[model samples]
Target: MTLTKKILLGMFLGIIVGIFLNLVTPQAYPTIETYILSPVGKIFISLIKLLVVPIVIVSIILGTAGISDPKKLGRIGTKTIVFFLTTTAIALTLAIGLATLFQPGVGNFQLEGAQFEGKEAPPIVDTLLNIVPTNPFEAMTEGNMLQVIFFSILVGFAISQLQGRVKLVVDFLDQANDILMFLVGVIMKLAPYGAFALIAVAIGGQGIDAILAMAKYFGIVLLALFAHLVITYGSAVAMFGKTNPITFIKNFSPALAVAFSTSSSSATLPVSMDVAQKKLNIPKSISGFVQPLGATINMDGTAIMQGVATIFIAQVYAVDLSMGDLLTVVLTATLASIGTAGVPGVGLIMLSMVLTSIGLPVEAIGLILGVDRLLDMTRTAVNITGDATCALMIAKGEERHAESYSEAIAES
Candidate 1:
């Protein structure tokens, strides 16, 4: 079977096993999860994560080095950032708007005595300042992606300037890039089993009650995600990249499945980059530059969840959000995507920031915590889709711009 087909079968079997464990033999869950499911899933994720830092550093260096002109690099950077921010803002607005219309939290909900301690989000200033790494080695060891990206880009740019002097370094990185990609291919052979274990654990542990209880909230989030994927990303790909939307999604399915299974954009980085370059025909230069940056900053899926959850929480507590308050949610969630980037359980952490911004009780998060894992899987898929869309569009634009520049030169 093709990899995508194998993955789908794994997901299917996982759901069946998960439901069986949840309902038929609940007692066996602990033993099975502890011994079988957890280990398999963690091993798979660890293997993928093991490659993430090196892939990011190598891909970004190779990407930047390929773009010999600094001005062109800056142009791509500007376009990429703009696309991510705009798409994120739109995602938040869509989530909030849907939640308001659906009123997912209108029914009776137990809000009293619920407890959830949220991690504090660092100040915006600190997040910005921390981007420039004082020690690149420490940043890589700690998996500080933004700093690694910064340092890699600088090294790539320096190599571009002194091409003759750094010929050996450039050739070495190119070879390293090939080796890393080959490793990714080998790791992906294990995705089917990995996906099965991860999904089984998630569904088995959470059970069905949590899903039924927050059915409205879950449905709303899914609807908004679907709309954004089809309308926002589909339109961008079709209009900007001038590619058929169905072709784009079909070609990108392997990476999306891994993203869905892993639920970590960073962990799925290698697969996504590979698909973009090989399947989607995105240039490595743009794919390397845009995707790593997007994984860190462009969190449209998580932003949507925060938007819907905020409204849902407010409704459950009998609190009314005014137009101004809704506006605050859009801004806070949008900015929090960047400010809280790379933190663990970042979706919930960013949600806490949004709640604190509008004086909502952070403890109310416990209400939806039960089902966040399932929703998290879907959102991660959406997040990387947005990243790939940005990369493809940027590449197409660069191609057109280059053609135009060549034409102008010929005319001159």
Candidate 2:
């Protein structure tokens, strides 16, 4: 079977098992989900974690070295950052608009103090400084993908200036990357076990009671995610890239699928870069730099969730947000996205920032935390979609030809 078919089946079966586990009494299915099923999920995520640093380091190194002209590389980087920022702004705006319309949190549901602790978000200037690595080796060991990407591009650019060294380093990394990619392929073959395990454990442990309790809010977020994917990303493809929408979607599916299951833009970074650089035929320099940055900062999906969620919370608490307050939510959420890039448990904390900006109660954030993980997964999928979309757009702008990245299955 095709990888896509296998992945799709894995997703389907995982969800089914999760739902079934939820339906069964804990006494009946307890041993299975907790022991066998849950471990599979943990292992799958562990595999992703295992591959994350090496895959990113290798891909970025190879990608940057491929650029013959360092000037073109700079241009690509500028174009990509601009595209990511623009799309992120648009995504936040769309989320606000849809959230205002749907008001996902406006329902009869009791909320408790949620378990959300936020790490510090550095000043914007400081954050930018952090992007430049002081020690590349330490960054890789720590899984500091941003620093790794920055150093990779620099190393690649330096190598470009040396003809003999460029060829030698590029060829070496190219071979190493091929081996790492092969490992990824091997891991993928074990996806079914991972998917089933992860989903069953998450579902069985969380249970449907949690999902059903906030059904309206959950549904609204999902609806907004669909709209954002179809309208925002799709429109960009149609207008800028001049690619067929269905074709773009087909090409982007593998990355999106992995993003959805993982619910982490960072974890999904390697796959997205691969699809963009290899499958889509976008240059490595563009894909490598842009995908990693997008994982860190360009969170269209999270922005949308915050947008809808803020409004939903306001409506639920009967907190009459003035026009000024609504605008505050939009601007705050957008800025918070950039500010909280590396902060842990940022979703709720960012929401709290938005609420405080509008003089709303911080407690309202608790209302949505129950379904946040599920929503987080959906948003991540859309965010990566936007990343790929931007990569294609920049590729077109650079007069770089982009082939369908989804052709990996065919090549395999």
Candidate 3:
């Protein structure tokens, strides 16, 4: 079997194994998880994370330097940001519409017992201000994505300016990118084992009771995620990327599976980049530039979750949200996608921000906390899919523009 099939099998087996452990060997599950499951999973995640900072900085620099023209760089940047924000808004719209139609929160839920201490979200200006790193080395050391992006782009810009003089630096970056991509290929060999262990841990630890208790909420979240994946991504790939959506999904499934298992957009970066370049035929320049940026800011999946969960919480609390409140949820979550990027536990943090924006109790987060892990896996898959889709569209546009320029030159 191919590697993707192997990874898929591992995930399937993980589900079966996880359910078995959860139901039959509940006693031994902890010991099993503490040693075997957690270690293997952490190793996989650590292996992926080990490559993230270097790959992002290197790839972004190369991508920006390849564009060479500052005008093209700025144009691509505008496209990336606009695509991310627009899709985020669509995600919220789908999520809220579905939640309203379904009324998943129309059941009895206790508010007093909800026990979540939400982290305070930083101001948007601070997130923007800190984008330019104080110390670029410190940013890289801390894995600060915003600062790293800022420094890398500036370096790429400088390299592009002194292209002939800095040929050696560009060459070094090319070799470094090659090395990182090779390491990604080698690390992916461990994926099936890693996927199996990590998913087993997620499913096993999340008891069946919590899943059953929150079945409606869980189902609603999944439905919204499914809608976003099918509607938003499928349409983007078909219309904007100018490719069959099924082909896109088939080619991209390996990364999707990994994202589902790992639940980290940053961790899935190397795999997604490789898949984009080789499988989806996106050029390295676009893949590197768009995806790392997308990973940080393009959070359609998380935005969908926040939208549905906010409405769900409001309905459960018997608070009728006006048309204005729904609009606020959409606006708040869409902006929060970028503003809350790089924050730890950001999914929940963003959700809390959405809750606060509309006068919902932040502690209401505890109500859906039970099923968040499982939903997280699925939404994360959606999240990376969004990033890849945006990259595909941008790459396609660049391809067409190049072709048009060639044709115009021939005519002239």
Candidate 4:
């Protein structure tokens, strides 16, 4: 069977086993999770995590080195930011609109004694300042992704400008990237097993009871995710990338399956990059540059959850959000996304920030925490799809731009 087919089967079996464990054999869950699911899933994720930082550094270096032109680099950077911001805004709009229309928060929910300790978000100015790495090695060691990205881009830019003087260094990075890519290929053989173990644990640990309790809220988040995926991403792939939407999703399925199981965009980077190039036919340069950056900042899926959660929380408290309050949620979440990059448990932190902006109770975050794990897994799948969609469009635009330039030169 093909890899996608295998991974799909794994996911199918995982859901079945997870529900079985949760509903049928609850007592055995602890043993099964501790002995089997945890080890196997961790091993697979560890293998992927092992490659993420090195691959990000080398691939971004090569991507920047390939561009070499400062003007073009600036253009790509601008385009990427625009796409991320625009799509993120659209995601929030869709989420809030759906929540409002569906009235998922209409049911009776307990409001008191809901306690949650939310991590505080950093000041925007400080977050921006911290992006520049003081010590590149320390940044790499800590897995400080924004700093690492800044350092890598600088190194890549310098290598491009120095040209022949750094030929040896450029070649070294090239070979290193190749080796890492090879490692990714070998590691992915374990993906089916990993997918099965991870999903089963997630579903079993949460149990069916918790999910059914907040069924309306959970269903709204899933519906918003599906709508965004099919409507937002599908339209972008077809209209801008000039590719069939179904084909784009099909080619990118391997990465999607892994992202769903892992729930970590950073961990899924290597696979997504590989799938983008080999499967989606995106050039290595664009895939390398865009996907790494997108993994850090592009957060449409998380944004969707926050949007829905904000509205859900408001309804649970019987406080109607004014027009201005809804707008506040959008602005706060969108800007907070950039500020909170690399923060642990970032989705919750950003939700806290959004809640504060609208004067909602922060402790109310606890209400949705039970089902958040399942939502997290689904939203992650949407998150990476946004990255690939942007890469495909950028790749297409770059191609057309190059063709136009060549035609002008021929005419001249």
| Candidate 2: 10-residue stretch with minimal lDDT | 400-409
Q: Whole-model Cα lDDT per candidate?
A: 0.94, 0.74, 0.92, 0.93
Which should have the higher lDDT, number 1 or number 3?
1
Flag regions of model 1 displaced more than 4 Å. Answer: none
lDDT of 1 by residue, 53-127 (tens): 999999999899899999999999999988998999999999998999999999988878568999999887799
* Poorest lDDT segment (10 consecutive residues) of candidate 4: 105-114
True lDDT of residue 210, candidate 2? 85
Residue pairs in steric clash, candidate 2?
Answer: 41-198, 105-312, 279-405, 280-405
Candidate achieving higher lDDT, 1 or 4: 1
1-412, model 3: which lDDT tens digit per residue? 8889989999999889899999999999999999999999999999999999999999999998899988889988999999999999999999999899999899888778898999998898889988998899999999999999989999988998999999999999999999999999999999999999988998899989889988988998899899888888899899989999999999999999899999999999999999989999998899999999989988888888898899899999888999998888888888889898999999999999888888998988999988899999999899999999999999899888889989999999
Which candidate wins on TM-score? 1
On the 0 to 100 scale, the lDDT of residue 66 in model 4 is 86
Candidate 3's error at 392, in angstroms?
0.9
* Candidate 2, 253-363: lDDT as tens digits: 777777777778887776777777666787776676667767877877887777777778778778777888777777777777777775667677677777677776776
Candidate with more favorable, higher lDDT: 2 or 4: 4
Model 2 clash number: 4
Estimated TM-score for each candidate? 0.99, 0.90, 0.98, 0.98
